[model samples]
Every structure is written in structure tokens, then in C-alpha cells.
Target: MSLGFAYAAGFVLATSTGMLTLLGSGEFPPWLWLALFAPSATAVMRARNRQAPGWLGTLIGGGALIYGTLVVQSQGASGVLIGSTSGLLGIFIARLVTRTTLKHDLQALMLSLLIVIAGAGMNSGVSYGISFVAYAVSVVWALVTRQLVEGAEREASLPFGATLEVTLARRDIVTPVFFAASAMVSLVVLLSTSFLFVLFPRVGLGSFKMAQNSGLPDSVSLRGSPMAGGSGAVVARVKGVSGTQIDRGLYLRAATYDRMTRDAFVRDSELVGLQRSEWARLAHHEDARQYDVFLQPVTDGHLLVLG
Candidate 1:
């Protein structure tokens, strides 16, 4: 029960992010954000054992579905899809509150995934990326929590009590460490999968472009002027620095030219793998500055900033 609330809250956040991303991208109307309260209120009412009859939920859900379909015939398809998803979400919420099975939960999760996928397909902006990350983490956490407790909960069902009894782990099955460990695992999954996605060659998808567009040479020949073929467009965005730091400027070390001639310096074309690991002890200062860097897919070897 302790883990259940965490999972529920995370699930809500993931769904909210997906909805907001779609809304921000103009895929749906602004009022769609307010529709989240339907499921939320139903879940809370059920928790308090004061929920209305299942017929009420069905009526509302059916009405919503019919309205969304009418919307599809008259206007935007994106809005209709999202509206139908939200209606299904509420129906699943009712199922979850009224049953002891996992069918409804899985159905809701899938619908949430559909929303996120739609948003991703329509928008490649930072908001959609953030929505994806939040959805990924929440899905990971919810899966972990559900898998661990499903059997136990089924066995521990009661006749006169609620199925889920949620508390903040004051003296319960889940603790802060459990949440932290799940978050770390989610991070690992996100990083590994993202790296694999970027590293995979997508030549058929037409993602790769001519090196001249990136302002960098594809292979070193030392024949042409290295600086002559590049664009002056922005490649990356850095956050957490002040205006003063931006005014001072930054120097970037993008690549190394190990093989050089008198005419020009050359870098290796297929110089493969190198891996290194070391540990060092150093004095720490009270003040340290850290910032986040977001880079566009400009080159195989990404840009690096130096102090």
C-alpha cells in the first residue's frame, strides 16, 4: 500500500506530462488539462469508500466517448484521439477502484503510452522530450511496484476493508531507499536506450546529412580548408549560467587532429574504441557550478566545452 500511492502519483505525473506536451504543441484544446480531475476525483472518492455506483462512471465515460467521436467528425483528429483517451482513462479508473484485478491498470498504462507516442510524433521539441522522460521513469517505477505487490495484494484481499491502504512509509513495506533505487534504475534504462538510439545508424530514415551542413569535416584529407565548410547556426543550448558567463564566451574542443602534416592537421577516420576508468581523491570546495547542456544531432562527435 505504501508503494501503491507512490506508483499512483508517478503514474498521474506521467499522464499529466503527456497531456501537457500535447496541449502545448496545439494538439488539443487548453481545457483538456482540466479533464484530469475526473479520474483523480473518482479515485479519491473510491479510496474514501464514498464512490458513486459503477453505473455513474459508465454513463460519464460513454458520454465522453460519444462527444469525442462527434468532435472527430467536426474538427481536429488529434483533439478527438486525446479526448477519447481521457475518457478511457476515467473508465479504467472506475475499474481499478471497483475491482481487484490488473486488467484495468494495464489498459490505462497503454492508453498513456499512446498519448505520449502521439505527442512525440507531432513534436520533437524539448517539452515532448521531457514528457517522454517523465513517462519512462513513471512507467518503470509503477511496473516495479506493481510486480512486487500484485501477488501479495491478491492474497491479502479483505471483505470489509479497502484493497489499497496508502501511507508515506512511516512504518511500511516501502521506504525512501526503495524510491531512490527505482529512480536510479529508471535513469540507467533511459540513458542506455537513448545512447543506443543515437548510435544506431538511421540512414534509411534520412536523418543523416552532409558534413558541410554541420560545419565539420567528415574525414580528414588535409586537402581543403577545414574551416571553409560549415554553418554558423546554433548547435547546443547551455543552462544554469549567468549572462556574465555568456558575455565572457566559451571555447569548445570538438575533435582532436592526431595525424597532422605541414599543410593541415588530420584526424583519424575509423580510429575505433577507447575505454578508460580511474579514481582520484581531490579536495572539495564549498562552491561549485554545474550546468546542463542540450545538443542537437549535428555531428557524430559532439561538441565539448572547456573551462
Candidate 2:
């Protein structure tokens, strides 16, 4: 159950962040970095000599640095720069705090700041701006609740379930507190997951929608005549035409669109009913063209054209 819970938590965290990125955030999607959790599982081993690999920590630190640099460069100097810089600096400060005399007291504060600020910086956007903070809080709350559960379990295991009589140390109390706190964290995760899913757009998987450009007014197809002194890509050539026969605007269809929505043009279904005869007539006309047609490699699906 513990392993299942951990894996589910990790997956949920990753998947939620990934969805948010698609919704137009600049943050490094958590789903892409969930592999970072592998090192965390080392705590479960519990063997006397078992320890997390130093390389794991180094990799995370290095990865964060590289990620910060990329975010700074891609977003321009002032876009996400302040947030990214703050996050990286926070991580450094957290590491220093962990190494000092006030380490125990400052650990949670540093860790919380590192996750909340860094995560927010990594994936900034209007809709998902607070996601990182929620995620950080959830994690901390879960840890606290888990600790509380462990202490409660230990006390309950005593003879006659003597937890009622047992006095808990501050450390012991903390674990149960964490366990209860996990309930609230779970709720937050559930809410965040729903928020992302409901708002994230569902775009066609293969088609890319280029941003609008008003400047490029003229367009030409591959079947259009070659430019002066330029060898154009041959999509088709007319044959069996007499010397005087001239071609006008020849129609070429590269893809078909059938379904139209308020915002999208979707692939038309080939399902036949009353439309069979109408479609057949069009197909017959297309087949009669004496054009030696060439087609570029395309998605492996049936292509249809309508005049």
C-alpha cells in the first residue's frame, strides 16, 4: 500500500503538470521529470548501510541549473527571469541551511520554499500560476500526516492497543499530525487535477495549428505552376494533351475536412448513407483527370477531395 501510494502520488504529480504545460504554461512539466522520484524510493530500503546515491543529488542539482538557464534564455531576460533566478537561489540557500546549526528547524522552511518557488518559476502561467504552491503544500502535508500515522500505528501495536494510555513524544506526535495532514493534501491534488483537465484544450494529435500571420496573403500548392526559372516540386503533370491544349487552374487535394466546429476543422468520416451517390460522382470525375500525380508522404489514412 505504501509503495502504491507513493507511485500514485508521483504519477499524479507528473501527469497534472504535463497537462498544465499543454495549456500554455512556461513551466517545466512535472510529468517529464517524475523519474526524479526514483532516488526518493531509496528511503524504503532501510538497510543499515543503504544510502541514496550522491550522483542522484548531483544530477538533480545540475538538472535544475541547466533548466534554469534554458528558461532564462527562452523566456527573454525579463519574462520568467526573476522567478527562475529566485528559485535557483532558493535551492542554494536551502542546501546551505541544511548544512548549518539551525538545520533541523530550518529544513522544512527551506524545502518548502525550494519546491514552491522553483516549481512556480518553472511552469508559470495565469491558470497554473498557483499549481506549484499547491503541490508543495500537498507534499509537505502528506509527509507530516504519514509521520503521524506511523506513530499512531506503533502505539496501537502495543499490548491491548495501548495508544490511549501512551504519551507521545513531540517527535512521535509529529508523525500522526502528518498522517492527518495527508487528507487535506489529497483533496488539493484532486482539485488541481480536475482544474487542469477541465480547462486544457483538446487539439488534434497530428495537426499543428500555426499562429495567424496576416502578412502572407498569397499561397500556392505543389500542383501550381513552377515559378520563373525555379523548378517547382511536381505534384502532378498533364499528359495526352495536344500541343495547343492549355491547362487552367488544376485542383489538387492534399487532405480532406468534413467536420466543422466553432473553432476546428476535423477529419470527415467516410461513412456512407445517402451521401454515397454524391461522393461517387465526385470520385469518378477525379479519376478521369489525365494527370501524372505525385504525392508527398502523408499520414497513413485515406485522403478525399471535394470540388
Candidate 3:
């Protein structure tokens, strides 16, 4: 049961991490704070060998569905998504309170995964990455414990008229060796995943963010110092196309300057949008060097090109 509880803790960790991510992304409703109590309450009941009544679950589910319907008029399309997830939230909580059944556990796990995937698409920050890593670790831990628990249940299957009683300190099951083994196994899983991530890189895991800017200023000012260019951070990486060889030194144009000053080069305040027809009319030279430029995300969405 201690091992089972440990697995439950992992389940809670993964679910909570996912919910927090969704909340941060503004995809999840703020009512998540109250919804969290269901898992916490279920965990407590699981530890005490108690099951919440069936009617209570029905009431919770029904109430959630009703509330979701009521908010649809005010919230619009997002309200519909919120309402559906909230309804499922009740079902998820209901499953958590039930006895150790794979159906119940699997359903809850999948639901948590749904939230996690949604969260992954919504945010691209260090905190979200940390949460995802923690979620991954907890998922691994939960899966291991879940398998062990199922085997234990099968072995200790109770027949009619037979009551099983278990009384043992946590230290008996959760020994130092158990923890050491868990840590090593977790480390191995993390390292393996990290290695694969580095090798294949990003392979369509999440949605593409529309934000294409970095933390640089939109307009340049030569008011301060004579120095040009930005802090030594990389702006873009260039690679030659076909069999073409890149020159050792080349001037990469970012923005064109209309006027030059003793202090700094001044860029035109009024900029015109380049139309498709205008781009097509430009002269095309066969001898012009061609290279692929991979630019990093920046706050200033400016095009950096090599001539």
C-alpha cells in the first residue's frame, strides 16, 4: 500500500504539473484551485482505505455539467472548451477515488496528458520546460509503481468472506535501497530522453508560435556610443545552399539606413510593406549568392539577410 501511495503521489504530481501549465497558458479556468481538492481528497481517502460513495461522484459530475452549461452564454467558444474539460475534471476526480483499477488509472492519466500537451503548445518558457521535465519524471515513476501494484493486487486477490488486513511501517517497503534504485532509474530515463532530444531535435511536438521577435530594439539609436551591432549574442546562423561555399567575411544586412549622422546612422521612420507583386518585379541575378539563414526568435521582427 505504501508503494501504491507512492504511485498515487506521482500521479498527483504529473496531473498538478499539467494543470499548472495549462493555467499558466490561460487555457485552463482559474477554478482549477478548487478542482485540485478532488485529487488531494482522493489521495487522503486512498491512504485510509476508504472509497467515496457513487452518488457523490454523480452529484459532482452533474453539478459540473450544469455549471458549464450556464457559463456558455457568457464565455463563447472558449467557454465551450472550458465546460467540457471541467465536466471531464469531475469524472477524473471520480476515477481517482475509486479502487485500484487500470481503467480508472488509465483514463485519468490520459486526461492529464491532454492537459500537458495543450500546455506545451501554449507556453515556451524555461518554467514550462522545467514543469514538463518534472511531469516526465513523475510519469515514469508512476508507470513503474503502477505495474508493481497490479501484480501485488493479483497475488492478493481477495475471495468472498475473506478480509485482508495490512499493517506495516513505510520504511519496510520504501527502504533506502528502494529510493536509490528509483533515483538511478529516473536518472537513466532522463538521460536517454535527453540524448534522443539532442539527436533528433524538435520533431513536430507542439504548435508553431506566431511570435517571431527577439529582445532587441525595433529602432536603432546611435545616441549613446560609437559601437555598432548588438551584444555578442548570435543573431542568425547562415549556411551555403547547394554546393556553394560561404565567404569568410560577408556583410549581413538587417535594416537599411536612409541617413547618416556624426553620432549614428538613422533609419527611416516610415517603412512601406513589401507587396508580392513588388517582390516578383525585382531583378533576379543567377550569379547572386544564395544561403539559408536560420534566425533565432527576437522581440524585433526584422529580416536579416546576406547579399
Best by lDDT: 3
- lDDT score, residue 286, model 2? 36
* Candidate 1 local Cα displacement, residue 121, angstroms: 2.4
Candidate 1 C-alpha lDDT tens digits along 206-272? 2454642433544444333333228775666778766556545543335534444556655665442
Order the numbered candidates by lDDT, best leading: 3, 1, 2
Ranking of all predicted structures according to TM-score, beginning with the best and ending with the worst: 3, 1, 2
lDDT of 3 by residue, 1-307 (tens): 4766676787787677766665565555576667666667776776687887777777777887787677676798767866766666666665666635655777777877776776666666676778777777776667676676665566557563212224122336655576567667867887887666656534431223345332346455433332224666676676754322333234444553444555665665544243233223322346886666776533142344544
* Candidate 3 worst ten-residue window by lDDT: 161-170
Point out where model 3 deviates above 4 Å.
Answer: 1-5, 26-29, 66-73, 78-84, 98-103, 123-125, 158-173, 183-307
Which regions of candidate 2 fall more than 4 Å away from where they truly are?
1-26, 29-49, 70-76, 79-113, 118-137, 146-307
| Every model's TM-score | 0.53, 0.31, 0.54
Residue 36 local lDDT, model 2: 35
Cα lDDT of candidate 2 equals 0.42
